[model samples]
Target chain A: MIRAERVTMKFGRVAAVNGVSFEVAPGESVALWGSNGAGKTTLVRCLLGILRARGRIEVGGCDARRRGKALRSLVGYVPQELAFHDDTRLGSAMSFFAGIRRVPVSRARELLDQVELDGHERKRVRDLSGGMKQRLALAVALLADPPLIVLDEPTSNLDAAGRAAVMKSLVALKQRGKTILFASHRPDEVASLADRVLVLKRGRLIEDTRPSLLWPSEAGVLTLRLFVDAERESDAAGVLRGAGHLVNLNGHGLCVAVPGDRKAEPIEVLHRSDIRVRDFQVLADYQPDWSRS
Target chain B: MSSGAVQTAVPLPRPCSAARNVISFARREVRDAVSSRWFVLCTGAFAVLAVGVSFMSLAGSGSSGFAGFGRTTAGLLNMIMLIVPLMALAAGAGSIAGERERGTLLYLLAQPVSRLELLLGKYLGLGIALTGSLCIGFGLSAGVLAAKAGGADAAAMLMLVAFTCLLAWVMLSVGMVVSVVSRKVAVATGVGLFVWLALVFVSDLGLMAGAIVFKLRVQELFIVAMLNPLQAFKMGVIVQMNASLDVLGPAGMYASQTYGRTLPWMLVGVLLAWGVLSLAAAGVLFQRKKSI
Candidate 1:
């Protein structure tokens, strides 16, 4: 479904993407796991034929350079920075894209309905919350019903519910056998969605493996179980929450959501608040050693 | 629900939706211009100015006791020069740059349409809106004149309308160039205004100052005046009206002697060239620009 050979994008003296090459077969879902400036967006833009790069790219049998319109027609793209004018109606905006994509205008209505945005067609696009806008972007991407779907930072801007909503839409797309390549920093999204994970660092593809193997080593976020003094459990939960972790306080244990590479910070946070951790354990069901250096 | 990152067999969409895509983009530009009140204000201002200037010219020339077509057109031409280009620039200058700031530009570009198609669509839409407003504004004022006194030259009035619309097209091209080059709407608009002032007022003022200071020859003055489209438009009007050379100072008189009756046609040719070249230049510049 997609092929990129030695794609390199240089900006001034620095190469944003340096000699990156990969291919995705039909019916495959690949997740590009990278931090900021890892060249994910640059690489994707090169694939879309929107940026100048030194390489060859082919999507759905269309050459990215000579057949850009055809190549773009074969892929649905969702950008990271999403925007819609306050006065632009959802229906109008969608139909506008439908026309551009050479699909029937009715496709807009169908996709919006598919995304569960049926009743809000008349609502202004900018009036939508973060989740609705993201969904709308997905719908816009899905307009062409392209064989391949590409998204940059799919769930980064969404809340928990928004992320769930986006993933559900992706699941539907996947079940239809559409190849998907998405750049994300969220481990949960990757574990749930990606068949393969491509880890990138400093513009190079450092690792390529199945999600199972990559889960423990390069997960985008981490989950830890903090065992603090019972008297200070509520205070500990509060402290974790105040320190920017999502805390789930239950009888079993206090599970605090910590991002990858920052799992040690939660334990340190509790210690600073005069709380003793009797014994803390990692609660990640898929991989206990995830985020361990 | 299926787990995550699965491929689906979605139906493929057809390709090359260029015609519909261009029309949709143009319609979007029109909607944006109208909704933002730029269209309404320009139309309203032209209407008011047209009526006021026509009546003042009619009353000022009381000896005729009637508003002649030629007299009203002469007054309207001066106003059109001041209004049409400026209004067109205002409508056009913020088009791409303003949308870029609002993130609409990149969103539109992300679609399947080509870059040239997008720019051409915008130019068509903005040109139509500006041209339509000019007709209505001038038409209303013309209607008032015909109703009050009558006997205006129908042919001459129609020619003025045509020329005015063409003039708007010329300025729209200039604005599109500004919009493409500027990163911000304010900068585009500011540059557009500067262009208007330089071409309409400052250029003429500068020429006059140079003429006085250097005591330049008539041939030198005519050559310099020919470089400006505004000067060409004015010369075309003068030639059409068969105005006397005395009022035109040395340049017009010298140009008349050098070119004879073919001078107005040459000036009109220059105006047409201005519109075509500006649009072509805009297309070339915009095609090379990288969208966000």
Candidate 2:
């Protein structure tokens, strides 16, 4: 549960976040998608009350700037950069955070378990891998079981498998009724996981849409490939085009683009025409407006 | 969903509990500093040096045309004053700058803690750490004295230790201010060293030059002495240890004799003023720093 109204942050002459407004409801998972320097991190810092801003910010129903401490206690923040006191063991690090947050020490073990770093309590922070360090940071943030979690590029440094594990843990957090606001530049992650995507360009919000709404129902596109004898490839392309599909000859096969969820229809069309259907895949369902023009 | 279906619960905000917050923050700082290996090494080294110097001075006094009780105490006090400030500066110069470099300051400030609490806690922590070292060093110096002269110098040693601790407090506070104001550890360390040099060496040289050029009276000379922490510290120790040394006037030379009952309080006031002013400046600076 976090709300920001007309928030603007400026550094010298540059407005890092300009008049941005958004709300994250309890138990909602929202992805903040943007390229580098797109103000996503600035927005998160403003919400956390770590950065001074021009407009109103509230976390868990408390004013962020005025009630920063209480707001801090109600929110968990995982910064993009995993920073820890290198010489301290994981357990001591957790305990220190718990002490600062006024949380019980026993919760540290539970948090370590949640991040799948249970037995790593005694390992020094410097000894951890990039992924393990990120996990430990997450565990420290979760010490107080804050109602809302803000992650700034949480999986940016993780490998493919590590990213998957982090995403899985986030999904688990969502199930447990924790609201999450994650900022990332990776498109695939946003496509697969975000319930609502907020697209930012040059410190401005360009689009806010659901994954399903991103692709129009009647305009959904599919790429279909047909395999046949080298001499018959041209004929196969003609047959598919005659069936009201756009067809083009690709290297050794025919590629067809059919409108309105015609993937099944194209296969049937190939069978009837005696054209062999080799393989089919959807390259992308939604065509971004910037590329269309 | 209808707008009426949306439910929002807002809890009343509470004021920060200053006393509890200060105590907890102070405790955390003390724990962190005391548990570190650097603190242990620095304290051990200070004790050994102070005791070794005291023993050497006592044993070699006769061959070198042995100075009397007053000069001997003055020399020992001079060493304490120098070493104590150095120790305090080393401890406090990196207190905040080191945290910023390590990226832990943000995490600490993100909590419910106020800027005042952070500054005060850090000051208190360094004070306790340095004081512990000073006490051990002072204890070793006292033991050396007892073995050499047998109970004659006990009172003087205790007084010297107390004054040296006060002087260390002033240095620690100034270093904390520099640490908070500077962004990098290197810059803070450089500035702290410069300040120590000015106070200990340059200021006294400046005072002597002024006295020579102006043909100032002995009483007027005492005014310039007040400007230097090292002078105040040394004079405070000398006056306490021996009655014969006329350094403050017929009252011994510095006017410390005339200000008898009030001199200790005055020195204390000066140290407290330094601590308070520097600490307050640091608090204000921290309140404005952008989180990284």
Candidate 3:
């Protein structure tokens, strides 16, 4: 359980997180929803006591700032970036974390199994794919079996399969009664895992409600701009069109309409046709136009 | 739930003791440093330089065999003074700033470890690693000398090695302070090199300029030398070997007359002060560091 009252953190004249207040009951799964620079990560850092902020923050009833060690002991954190040393072996990392967290290596091994990373202990961190590294981070977080799990955009960088694997593990963790708090901008991710969504905008909490009430799971659409080589633009457009996606050449790139949860599909389709997308950006969000289709 | 009641209700994992956390982190640092390419290169350089100096000293003297520990150590002084500080500075400068660059500092701080424990453990581990390398380098040279030159003054050699280790600690402490304040590893390394240049080269030049321009007295020069850790180390070795500072000219003679048999201990104290003061400052700066 966590309680925050008017928490605010400032960098120079700008407040990264401002006067946000919330609470989570034990065993509850909550999501902090926001766009980039929307204070979600800052708020999470404040809660974790990594950043010093003004206001009262209590994790399991103790002030987080006053009792950081205990707060960390109660919360297992998975950062958005996988920053393990490339030369480090999984087994060595596990053992080192175990030693610091004062847990037996057996507990770390069990965690590895829980995260489905067993039998790859000898593999170096660099050899693991994006998803495997993320999962290993998760296992490291669970080294001491902390009561709460806090994740910062857990699947934001993963491919479809990688996202699915991490999502499956998270769903299982929720079922096992671990209090969950995560920061994400993906509607479907919040819908799938969050019981309550706390929407943040520009350093302030704008909305706090049920995820279903905030966004219908299947109704959202995202417009994306995919940039490819100039010579291959037509080929990329043809491949997307062949996949039944409505595509338009916008001079700069091809604009494709995608369902919110199926955004990875267009990129995957392009990859399958050997059309490499140099870059992509979400242009806008709106409901799909049925008449145009 | 109220704070007291919740704490009583849930059983949390007990955090590692401060000493245990420091030791564990230190052991990992040692392993990392020992396996690093820089450590290997540094050890090899020391060995080669030691052997070269030992052989060169005897050859330069037109002697028949390799020099013993006393002669070899005296000849190797300048090389140790140049190499040890640079290696220690590079190692310490990279420690925290490199972790920050790689984004692992945030992850490390997320665990139940204190900043003091991490910093102290890092210092201890690096100190051990540097000490180990120095011993191996000197040991190899000593082995050759013992076989060819018959017997040697092991005590004199040990003293030099000990002083060199202390010098490494002093520079390492200074480098850690730089690492703590720097935002990037590259910046820390640049600043460390600048400091090394200042201490090793510029300081002596400045002292010479001051002696000429201000007509500094021998006693004043001796005071200044005591303040400069490098000069103090050199002077300490000379006093240990010759039992008098006559070879160091007027300032050395002044120091010998003033401190007498206690000069070596005084110089040792100066090195200790440099290490301790720099380390203490680093600890304070590290504790106050807010950003990862």
Candidate 4:
């Protein structure tokens, strides 16, 4: 678990993170959604006790600023910048981080496997591709199996499939009861993976909402295109409304507003109503303004 | 899990983890220094250059020549003055800057280790690595002297080596100061080399000019020499090697007046001050540096 209370970090005249407060409960996966320079990475750094801030921060119940060592042992951080010592083999780098974390050295191999980078542990960091390097970094961060993991832009450099793979591993981590706070600008990743999202803009928290509760106005709204035989438009609308749907007759066909989850049920009702339903498509229910303005 | 077991599993006390973390950082720094190719190459080059210079001096002076001891000592001392600073600079010029460039410094500092401990560990690791290089270079030089000069005085050679080590420590401290102050490795390296040049060449020239222009007495010259570690080291080794070399003037009064007395202690104080100041500067800078 991680908590921040009124945390504010400044670089001279510029505020990198300003009066932001949030928490990631144990076993919960929270996504930090923001555009570039929105202070997502800065907030993550402040929580890790790497950056000096003006307010309180606690990691796994330890005061991050005062008890940095204890807090560090309980948390793993994967930085956005994937810079590594190129000369060291991946295994040696993992072992070295493991040694510093005072964790079991065997955890290196286990984590390497967990990140699906088993055979390439002996390769130098420079030899790894962008996705492979990100995985290796994830493996290093997981070496201690810390209860909380913070990832900044974990999929920013990956292709679509690579991003999906990394997201899958992160989802697996959440399933294993590890609290995760992942920051990214990718909406699809947040939509697909995050249980709860925190939107930030210009170092300020603008919105925080659960994905299930997003787009309330559009949640139960569906657009339907019905191809009814020449004389059946009135009959189709009557039948659709009788079936508990909001129907509107259009020039092309009958458009109906059905609850997003029950849009398919209306088609079944139309089939029994003697109305010809030629084609239909279900629109995804998502609000573009879920991110901060 | 049982209630008692869950209560007992509350992670170990904070102090234990903090101590372990500091030790871990120190160990990692030591490993990095040892494994660095730049460190290996610079130290190796210093050793080879020392040995080569020593043997060349011996051959030039002839094996059985009476002046072979003096030539070998001077050659070794000169090499130490030049090579030790270069080696120390190369070892430490990027200690903090290189980590920052790699973006790993923030990662390490993010842990519970205090800035003081981080700076201390890095300085200690670099000191150890430079000391190892000094030993190798000085050892090879002494071996060459013994082999080419039909076996020189072991005690005298050791004393010179000890003095050389002291000078190397001073260089290490200077390099650390530059490293912590500069944000880029290139800048740190440039500043370190500049300081080294000033100490080895310009300082002596400036002191000589000051003494000559002012027509100062030998006592003033002695004080100026004492202020410069490189000069003091050169004079100390010269005096240690030949008692009748007339290091001062025709009367050899300055040599007798300065050598084997409070001068060594004063130089020791200078070296200690440099070490403490440089390390303190590094600690302060680290404490203030933004984690980025």
The TM-scores, one per candidate, come to 0.84, 0.79, 0.85, 0.79
The sequence of per-residue lDDT tens digits that candidate 2 reaches over residues A152-259 is 888887876677777777777777777888897554555556778887766777788874465333444545555667777777767766775556665745655544
C-alpha-based local distance difference test score of model 3: 0.82
Report lDDT (Cα) of residue B219, candidate 2: 69
Off by over 4 Å in 4: A213-293, B1-37, B63-67, B212-224, B239-260
Model 3 earns a TM-score of 0.85
lDDT of 3 by residue, B1-292 (tens): 0111112122367778889999998898888889889899999998899878977765566443323455676789989889988989998999889888899988888888877888889999989999999899988877767666765577777888888888998989999999988889999999999998988999999999999999999999889877889899999887877756787789988888888878888999999999999888888988777666
Alpha-carbon shift of residue B264 in model 2 (angstroms): 1.2
Model number with the top lDDT:
3
Q: Candidate 3 docking: what grade?
A: acceptable
**TM score of chain A per candidate:** 0.77, 0.73, 0.76, 0.72
What candidate 3 gets wrong by more than 4 Å, as runs, is: A217-293, B1-11, B62-68
lDDT of each: 0.78, 0.70, 0.82, 0.71
lDDT of 2 at A274: 81
lDDT of 3 by residue, A44-130 (tens): 888888777899999886687788877877888998878888888898999999999888888777777767778999999999988
Instruction: Give each prediction's DockQ, rounded to 2 decimals.
Output: 0.47, 0.14, 0.31, 0.15
Residue pairs clashing, model 3: none
Estimate, for each residue in A25-143, the C-alpha lDDT of model 1 and write its tens digit: 99999999776788888888888877767888998888887887778888888877567777888898888788787777777777777777789988987689888888888888877
Tens digit per residue, CA lDDT, model 2, B240-273: 6545337445324446556776776665666677
Query: How far is A132's C-alpha from truth in model 4 (Å)?
Result: 2.3
Candidate 4 lDDT, tens digit per residue, A25-62? 89988988776789998998888888879999998888
- How do the candidates rank by lDDT, highest first? 3, 1, 4, 2
Interface RMSD in angstroms for candidate 3: 8.3
